[model samples]
Target: MANEVTTAPQDTRKPAFWYGLPVGYMSLDLLPPAERLMEIINQLRGLPEQERDEADRALRLYAGIISLLNTNRVQECALGVHPDDAGGFTTSVFTVSTLPTSGSAKLVVAGLAGSAADGPDEGMRPLELPCGVGFLAEKRSPAPRSSRHPERSDAASSHIWQGTVAVAAPSTPELIVLQMVTPDLDSADDYRNILLGIARTLTFTDPARAMAADEDREPEAPTGASAAMRNDFG
Candidate 1:
């Protein structure tokens, strides 16, 4: 069990966008049960607006939904990291989505679609995987992802198969969003790691590239993570 996070570095050349976080939130209306999407929006609305005095608001970015239809399967979930509570103002969230490497979050996410067959009570849990502890894995590719267990151990704790969603400009041909339900997740960072994995899983069809692919698309106009989401996602 390692807790190191790794991001792929470009070949001395940066993409238009960081490939870490997206320009803003995305909608999965193309496919879904409808209600599921609504749940995501409510979750975002539920987030406390006021900054807590105790916990250091280390997080600068967070992903949330404005409103979406519910669905049987997760078509998409508004995903992003945190820089500040405000919707826009910082590009930090973009960094998380654009991460060149997969990091622990991406590995877990890419493996999820395959792991879904083992019933619903197994594998990485929402709050556990992204927030879990592990060493970061580097890659020869431009973007590298960290391995979850790398070592032999007691499997993962994700309730649903999850992965990091590559943060690409909404303009991409297709995009993915994901979220999880677990008792352990308690902070924006926790959500970021898990969501990042979901994004990671979507980057490449090939397992290797899939693991390293971060933001596969280009960046959109700068509107900050949250603010851009409010307008784009809706």
Candidate 2:
């Protein structure tokens, strides 16, 4: 069995594999999720005072809701915010989970496809990931209860975009699932592409094996040494 961890190139302490999330995504997996979120929010600079205040309250609510929903199976989660180009922010929630048990990749895809087909507008299709085979499921639906505005009765009419990717572990029966949710339906295509790009970076491998492979790679010889070695060999 391999341990799952998302890491950056500069941080070797967290090993195994890392998701290449683009800029503007703030990780919330650190201890005390709310504090981590606040720290990230406070680090942001140059926003108007009122806008910054509103973002603070919104993120606090978002973090609170997320903390309640996250389960033990969730390996990683992050919140991404980007300019909507309409003076407001487009927010996204991204999570990666290890499913309980599934026989194989094919079975998992079949199961997902069956369920996805039942939804009126949901669609599922096969996807070839860099690490393994998987499927992509997408659907559009009314915003969740938490997403609705408290003061607006018509807020429920708003729609959200949900994209999910399920990839099988290379050497295990486990399925690594990545899901992204955003209420910015206008940018659905862009979000779908972002989700697919992140899915391709998912890999399942033992830390020890990955480190050993790096060590086994051939080192480049110095320029002069390479010529001398070539002449000597000739």
Candidate 3:
């Protein structure tokens, strides 16, 4: 079982993003890119044969989640554009599990301009937000049925909703991408609303200025309130 907790950054000035997992859902601390790769490698070493396969599958899923939130690079880019050249992009990921179901979800916010101003072409619908042109689309797929129980026909589907909130700027346009996957379609709207709430909190900050401020400051502990929340997972 995974350890779970409700965690958030201490800085209120920073935007608050949400995954709408049960309030106390477990939070996994992602290692910085370089360290995470090595950690995964170490975990795979010398596992019992029976446990190796399960470990591999879980690690792969965790790795894909880590890649989606790549933040160590000089620029934060989302949906294939850099925030400076485009605007800026920020991403957050969360792990969610309900009884027999478990999975991860991600939110990517990007600054857009020029040709990129137009959001996704298919299944797009308008969204009303104070800062951007917003639209949302939901995608679904049948969950893999159990092969052993081929005769059991009741199977749930997974859902992902890609929502975009494009802010119209004469020079720099921006959009927010909320991609969420859940075990069933019934909760898709709930997750959509959660992402929308987070997007509404979005505000543009000058990355250059933020970097300069960091340069002048002394190194500090990580963002979360507790050390456990700051501990990186293998």
Candidate 4:
């Protein structure tokens, strides 16, 4: 044996998208019509100040946990119709990820709405919504487009349930899927309106990409309660 030294394999893991508030969501290609989003904002504006304050508070609370935007890497997007729209209005995108946390168990949000092919169903449950994109992208960091993120040391925990919000029919849910790397889908939510915001603000809608995401993919297995999570919070 010559001069040989062994080193543990490098921990080569990377995030799929930029950091964002664990509360609000980011749409890939699934952008909604300007008119609709404006309507929503208007409606929110119309809400009693108390209710609007609550929504704003929830957003800010989640923002505290999110990191920042990283516009360097190439992310995915999709567009689809509102479940209630008999006309099938297409908008929005979904990203392929593990989960955003370190959980071992999983959750699923399947129903009259479609099921996820890539992961399992933890059954329908309110996810810690702030533990999602909204909280992840709270503030923008100084890192480069594709640079590594500062450690998530300050990331605080919050409890924002992913409760069910029904739509008309022929409907699939707007899912916020979280997986534990041994990777069971920990949670899924009907986040249509939640995600619709991202789609609404963005441009260039793609149907093909959206279809691919919704199509069934095999579920990922998980490790201990310490595995990585993609947190596909679409």
lDDT of 2 by residue, 102-137 (tens): 477557766765665565644787677656568898
Local error of candidate 4 at 152, Å? 15
- Model 1, which residues run further than 4 Å from truth? 1-8, 16-112, 117-234
- Model 1 alpha-carbon miss at residue 67, Å: 40
lDDT of 4: 0.28
Candidate 4, residues 111-219, lDDT tens digits: the string is 2223423335443223223223111111112322312433442242222222222211111112222111100012212343333232222211222343354455564
TM-score of 4: 0.21
RMSD of 4: 20.8
Looking at model 2, report the run of 10 residues with the lowest lDDT sum.
225-234
* Global Cα RMSD, each model: 19.9, 10.5, 14.8, 20.8
- The most accurate candidate by lDDT is 2
Cα-lDDT of candidate 2? 0.65
For residues 1-234, write the lDDT of model 1, one tens digit per residue. 111122221232222221122334333332335686576555555666663321123221121221212222222334333454555322212113222233444454444533544436433333222222222221111212226444423243222222333332222222233333221233434445544443332322223243234336465442322222233223
Q: Per-prediction TM-score, please?
A: 0.21, 0.62, 0.41, 0.21
Q: Where does candidate 2 clash, by residue pair?
A: none
Better of 1 and 3 by lDDT: 3
